[model samples]
Target: MKKYIIILSSVIIIIALGGIYMKHQYDERQEKNKTAESELYEKAKKRMTDYINANYEGIDKINFSNNYKMDQMGGINAEGYLNGDKSKEFWGIYDKSNNIITSSYVDAKEKPACKEKPCKY
Candidate 1:
């Protein structure tokens, strides 16, 4: 009877240890996933900035922040003051798949504006 009791206790301990190890592994995996997500977001933002710079020289010199958009053909949207001038603000939209800037609009005078619906891209 004593031997049987010892065996049962040992089994319970082993099972408990296993559960603890699994929980630790799960926590580690979650941390890694979070880190990967952050890295990906930063890389995408950089790509967006680079794309804008390639087209509009020196635009990348200014600080630009991007956010995930979820409305109306969602994509990464970034807007900031151009050439450090608040009045010259510009906004850009990056493609969701390639993280490439596809459309950009700058505030300027005497610009051909689009106010009507079904504007051609």
Candidate 2:
């Protein structure tokens, strides 16, 4: 009976340790995802700002939306609307791997352009 009790106790302790380890790993993963999201958001925001500033002179407060889509591979797609003309909007894709604007296109037509200014999306 004593031997059985010792084995049971060991099993319980191991299970507890495993649970704690799993929880810690999950938390770490979540933190990493959050960090990545924020980084992507900032990059997308900048892409929009640069586009508006270049396309239209003296346009400071163009409407910018947070990253609308985030891929597991750290790719992001977002849209920005011209402040003066809400109907005019552009979208851009940010590739986190190279930390650069992969593509941009206007809403009216999907013209993929590599230019950083005048976002192509």
Candidate 3:
């Protein structure tokens, strides 16, 4: 009876330790993913802002939609309104090569057809 209790206790301890280790690993991965996502968002914002600054003059308010999508090719598409004007919608794409593919300000009432590959949002 004593030997059986000792074996059972050891097995329980091992399982508890394994569970703890797994939980710790999962937390670490989540943190790392969060950091990576933050970095990506910042980079996308900066590149989009740069594009706006270079093209549009005397514009201050740049509001980005909290909803951004990542393409299968590791590119990001960010959409927003220009100067807080709902009518003036902007869509920017950040490619994998750190290149700003397109930044377009379109009339919110009508979204033009996407003719080319990787068309507007």
Candidate 4:
């Protein structure tokens, strides 16, 4: 009876240790995923801003619907679209302060080449 009790205790300890190890691994994976997601968000925001600065001159305010469709394109793909869409109203601003253009969304079109100031979207 004593031997049997010892054997059962040993088995329980092993199982408990295994469970703890698995939980640690799961937590690590979750943290990694969260970090990756955060990095992607930052990259997307930067790309959007750069696009806006290059395309429009004298931007004052950028307005867009709340449904900005951020998920459809991840970081790299979203940057590509910003580079390509000339007509998309992705940025707006009211004034250039300290040579900085501020907008709600990044407009990703080349500064208008024509001499006449382009019409606001």
Instruction: Give the alpha-carbon lDDT of every model.
Output: 0.60, 0.69, 0.71, 0.49
RMSD of each candidate? Answer: 6.0, 4.9, 5.6, 9.9
What is candidate 4's lDDT per residue for 29-114, written digit by digit as tens?
Answer: 99997777656545444544554554556654433333223333232223222334445555333222222323344433346562
Q: Give the alpha carbon lDDT tens digit for every residue of 1-121 in model 2.
A: 9999999999999999999999999999999988878877887778656654544444445676654888777788878776557787777777777766676755443223424344433
The sequence of per-residue lDDT tens digits that candidate 1 reaches over residues 1-121 is 9999999999999999999999999999999966765565565566655544544444435555444443366455666666677777766666667556567665533212333321232
For model 1, what is the error of residue 27's alpha carbon versus the real structure, in angstroms, after optimal superposition? 1.6
Q: Which runs of model 3 end up more than 4 angstroms from their true locations?
A: 102-121
Worst-scoring 10-residue span by lDDT in model 1: 110-119
Model 3 global lDDT (CA atoms, 0 to 1)? 0.71
**How accurate locally is residue 41 in candidate 4, as Cα lDDT from 0 to 100?**
45
User: Could you say which candidate leads in lDDT?
Assistant: 3
TM-score of each: 0.49, 0.67, 0.73, 0.51
Worst 10 residues of 4 by lDDT: 93-102
In model 2, residue pairs whose N, Cα or C atoms come closer than 3 Å (at least 3 residues apart or on different chains), thus clashing, are: 91-121, 104-120, 104-121, 105-120, 105-121
Question: For candidate 3, lDDT tens digit of each residue in 1-121?
Answer: 9999999999999999999999999999999977876678778888777766555545668888888888788777877877778777788777747466554553333213332433322
Better of 2 and 4 by lDDT: 2
